[model samples]
Target: MMCNSASGSAAGFLLFTDVDGCLVNKNDYGFAPAVPVLRRLRTEGIPVVLASSKTGCELQHLAEQFELEPAPLICENGGEILWRESDGGNTRTVAGAERSKILRALNGLKPTFQFRSFADLELHGVMAATNLSEAEAIRALDRHSTEPLIWDDAPDRIPVFAEYLQEFGLTLTRGGRFWHVAGNASKGSAMDIVIQHYRSRLTTPVTTIAVGDSPIDQDMLDRADIPIAIPDPEGRFHVQVSSNGHRAGEAGSLGWAETMTRILDDVTGCD
Candidate 1:
């Protein structure tokens, strides 16, 4: 069954967001400041689709927490897109190479690169490395299409390593905590997929607004009709993507709320 546009009209607005530094603060994992704005968006019939480097399992919980169920999720740095099926089951659309193949290629290069992959880090090890609770670590470890790893080799060798990965139809992306290896699919491509999915169902034009605060989010930002960047904890816009020549005034969820509020106001004339 098809869902109608969130706007309850011919036209709609969609929001794509990053998780760690945009909606939830890295230090406290709190999104209280964004709660009001999130409510407002929902009230205004905007679908808040979350696009993140997190796993599907992790995003599932977040989508629930934020009451965004039924919205498509872009997971593992755009390696996969997941959504709830009509029967309450889940459907996944993958865009990148399989995780096993990515791991196989990485293992072949183990002789030259010294890195520790998430698959090798078990639960407790991931907890120690990421400071996440056991449950969070488990959710984070659930991978479908990407492999995140810590590079133990010299920094200068990263470019060479990336080149090597490219030979196997893979690419490396830097994240907040680890470097990720996956197929060439990016957040920009994944967002396009989600947008197209909605467009096929909706009668009116959809306006996309993407928000994030990291280099990994550059692709998503590049794809948005309105790209909003949140400042880092230090109040500096850290994402390398173009924010449509604008930057949020604050950091974390506060900045997220402020920027979205301001942008939505400009876009829809909502107070």
Candidate 2:
């Protein structure tokens, strides 16, 4: 793990965090803990970017709630990278022929899988799965031997659901419970793009800290100088956090906040 020393006054540390599993609980509560922590980071002039499987619309709402200046938002499990308003209102989408090709191939394999584009689903709500329970959906996908993106209401089921999809050459990701099934695009890959963008604009080496909890968060966790998991007891992915707490049930967002504060203190030599 890379720790930023307080002895040197560098530009600032870049804090990359996931939304659903790391900062917000499955029920989307425990947002209070994150608000103050983020406020402190901003007061200290650190950059905190939200990188998640969330769509641009979802991320936009989160950014506003977090009081972020639209730091680079990574959406669709790294399939798209959008520079929030601060980075210029430029939104870079990674979906192109490759994504289209994958969709086409999947469609051919399972016609009843209800293939729909993100835009299409958002605008028309056509082909959306409105009747499937999380477990039922996964079972249905398994029976078909097809990996269809599922939109489950439960947040905790995402990791297991994603793992189950791997057998069918597909994976499940969430941008706030609207399950997204796509190719290998991941949050880590999108974070890489965000890091490179910042690196290009910097003269000094900047430290990157990625924090999340879930299988989808692994990519970003592995890419960070410091990876912090939010202490999910039900999580199948391995993560190392400084501490664990019980404020947010099994969701663990408050635990993540506590871990972040501890890690920052250690890095700053305040401990």
Candidate 3:
């Protein structure tokens, strides 16, 4: 928990965060108590980038909820970047083709297996299955699916799957639900692109901080000057910042907000 020394110095700091496992709760309703800390950072002119596996449509909605004024967004597990225009107009998506290709591949593989997109499967709808464990689904997916598949869970699973793919000279990324199998495109790479976009506007180097809860976030976390992970009940990822073992705390987006607050406190010396 090392806080930044230059807190309140008026320097521009970029905070890159994941949406699903970091900011919003798993249910996608309200943010954790720590969310105000992030809001404080924003008020101080610190830039917070929402790097997530959420779609552009979802991210757009989230940006509104956070009152972010079109901050940089990383979607589809970091395969895409969305940004607001300088004139504060509509948000623009930058990774359409890659996302389409991955979706096309996943759809192509669906006939032989049980695969569905988050958009296609509502959490409490007819398609929702309480009987099926995610692990079982992942095992089935790994055994039968030829195309790369991703089941959302531990952050370590992405690297593990990446390593598994490397054995076959292939690679896969874990997005919200649909696994992405294609050329090299990841959250880390997307974050890099976003950083470059900010770099072009400034003379001083920007300090990058990324927060996430799963293996898919590892690359972005590795790239960040500071990386934080919220607690997971299963203890799958083992991040430095463990929540007070709230077995069923806010899971997805709300968890992200909780972690962001911790990071913001460190970055802004709010403690």
lDDT of 3: 0.58
lDDT of 1 at 32: 96
lDDT top scorer: 1
Q: How do the predictions measure up, each by TM-score?
A: 0.91, 0.67, 0.67
lDDT of 2 at 48: 82
Report the lDDT tens digits of candidate 3 across residue range 1-271: 5454453543667888776545755433446554676667667677778876555556666677787745677766655566866576655545424434545555654554454453344333212432224532332222111233435455554565456445543456553334655446678888888889889986667888777776677788778776776555344554443342222234555555565565556456765
- Best candidate according to TM-score: 1
Writing each residue's lDDT as its tens digit, candidate 1 over 113-182 gives: 8999998888988888888999999999889899989989999999999999999999998876689999
Write down the lDDT of every candidate, Cα atoms only: 0.84, 0.60, 0.58
Residue by residue across 1-271, what tens digits does model 2's lDDT show?
3545444543557888877667876553457776777776765566788876555555666677788765777765666676766645665666312445545555553433443444334322422343434532332232111122544235565565456546555655544345567666677767777888888887778788887776667667777777776655465434434333112233556766787777666656553
lDDT of 2: 0.60
